[model samples]
Target: MDQAVCCYRHPDRETGIRCTRCDKPICPECMVNASVGFHCRDCVNQRGGTHVQPRTIAGGSVTSDPFLITKILIGLNVLVFVLELALGDRIVDDFGLYAKCVDLQTLQPARCGVSDGEWYRVLTSAFIHERPSPVHIGFNMLSLWWIGAPLEQRLGRSRYIALYFVSALGASAAVLVIAPGALTIGASGAIFGLFGATAVYMRRMRYDMRPVIALLVLNIIFSFTWANVSWQGHLGGLLTGTVLAIGMLYAPRERRNLVQWGTCAAVLLVTLAVSAIAVSQVTS
Candidate 1:
């Protein structure tokens, strides 16, 4: 069967897999699978010859696409943060962007129609914060890059990304429970999950996690003292990440990939649900 290879750039073109760089249709002669994906000769040259595949991709089964997913995620987080800052006070004036955090008894933000809802806040709150401070974004981006790259390489792309979203939700759940109407934002929750994962990995390998643990603890403690930091978000991410790492590392290796993935996913969802419910109870 002569299967048509689709052009990477042109969705309409029917051809074999084209070069990533030059957009040329490459037959077996010209196509070379790079570290990330298949590329044509011209494309390869543009990238400075052969692509440098990471140790994880060369040896690990995790998809390359997911491994690079963190970059996009981090970028999105930053963009949203920027928008929140630019909008500033006008957020209430122009856009309806309002804090969902509300007092259980009175619901201040909700009274002004500012607080959207608990569920919507669960997702949107992570992207909104007080001013787009470099410190806020910098800490988050740094944490994600440090934790996400290695974890993505180790766990593969899908699981790594799944962990990120799940942990963020979990962090949100935590914030919702502790502070019903407390305005929150940033990727600290997800970063905490990464910290959790690192802690678990270090423990599993019987390596000294003292340094990482100390760093995590110190950060967490500081979050309590630091008026601006979302301590609940940090705690939520850390707990979710720890649980997920345990599931990822301890589950039977012989189990199907789907089962293993599901296990980790289930943990994250369950954790989020529990946190949300707990928060509702506490606040109520």
Candidate 2:
């Protein structure tokens, strides 16, 4: 008079609960709570047995928290700025980018940079800003919030962060080549990188390009005209970001991740190679 059914996913487990959509029995492990009743993971994913995950424009996972990385980045910059104030200018002395290891007493290059293993400065210095002025950190954080959040949403966290550091390294490479002896610091390079990427994205999405263009032009002028600005870093980052964005956004969908990450890796290698040559050129 009565019949028994076993879970479809796990044959050994006996369950009375059936998925309302599929009417197939499911064990608790395979069950996802639904509004009406429990649903099999398959039913919930809505792709039959295999779940189809949502993907971002650049092939990263669609995430609930799109701006998480951007927020963390801004928090970090602000935290580091606070550290700069508390720790004094010594923080800058130790971390700021200059191609070579510099003797603190005379502030002259003591050895070949990056090649000799003090390579961390290339990326680290992007986080270090002038201690006295709030203007520098304020403007940069605002730019990061406004520009970075949207780009992060489009590219997703992994690609966005990769683009960021690559841009930083590109900026660092230019500093090493053009002004090796000078201590360069700030997020301007990375910000310019975001600006470049944003422009590419707008063009890709068929959005009006005039606003971003005008902003970029204004910033470029400011970098050159403003005293103590690192125009070299800005230009380097812009070029690198634009190139990287093209590779990411225009990659063939079938092999998107491979081509996208491969492009990032290639750009990174080229920047490092340039930095290596620059170290020798600047030191020699």
Candidate 3:
């Protein structure tokens, strides 16, 4: 047999393992585990790419299947819509978000009794939409598909999900504060949150932001101009997503994961606090 090859980085050491991809000798220090076998540092990095590959929470290269999470989210929305259609007003009455501050004294007790103090409505409402209005669900899901894949890839799975729910809560809180007597439903708040996050993240990455900015402006205008649109929900989710993105994108590299989680928690707590105050005001 020919003389054993030594690691490229460590000439003094001989290794039996060769990189699975490049077939180069790699010492323990230079070896990176792959699905098939060990790989050299160079080969691993090459496969992962030098630029444009997003990093995960643990700082490893993000190589998960693209748009996996986005697909699941869309699937969930569609499933819920189908269930709502079959169940009719029963689903809407139980799941749709109603203003906690609705004057029950003036309304029929049976109608208003279940509306107040239903905290779960804040989250469940996001999954339900007004029946017979395919336009509402259609536009929201389309926007989600447009932005969710890229944002999920950049932020990784955990952070992306966290940003979504927090932003949804923020929207619910806004509805309580700004329009506590109005019935609200739909994922527009979470979708708006994704939009805001994408806009901020793209700006930080030095990517062209005009398209995002224009979309945001047009959406804001549409929220205000369109009858029955909840501008408060849109604004609340947008602000929350933007703030969370700022924390995630600008955090110190030394402690990035900690800062990102902490920022999300802080935003969630503040939103809950605001919601609590609003509920108290309504009940009082």
Across residues 97-205, which tens digit of lDDT does each residue of candidate 1 receive? 2234344587453443223333554555555445545777787788788878777766666667777878877787677667545556667788788889878766654
Q: Which of candidates 2 and 3 reaches a greater TM-score?
A: 2
- Listed per model in order, the count of residue pairs whose N, CA or C atoms clash below 3 Å is 6, 0, 0
Model 2 whole-model lDDT (C-alpha atoms): 0.84
Q: Write the per-residue lDDT of candidate 3 for residues 112-209, one digit (tens) a residue.
A: 41136678888888888777768888988898899987788767777888888898999988988888777888999988899999888766645557
At residue 73, give the lDDT of candidate 1: 77
Model 3 poorest ten-residue lDDT run: 51-60
Estimate the lDDT of model 1: 0.63
Q: Which rank order by TM-score, best down to worst?
A: 2, 3, 1
TM-score per model over all chains? 0.67, 0.80, 0.78
lDDT of 2 at 33: 45
> Which one is best on lDDT?
2
Query: How much RMSD separates candidate 1 from the native structure?
Result: 12.4
Best by TM-score: 2
Stretches of candidate 1 above 4 Å error?
A: 1-67, 89-118, 256-259, 275-284
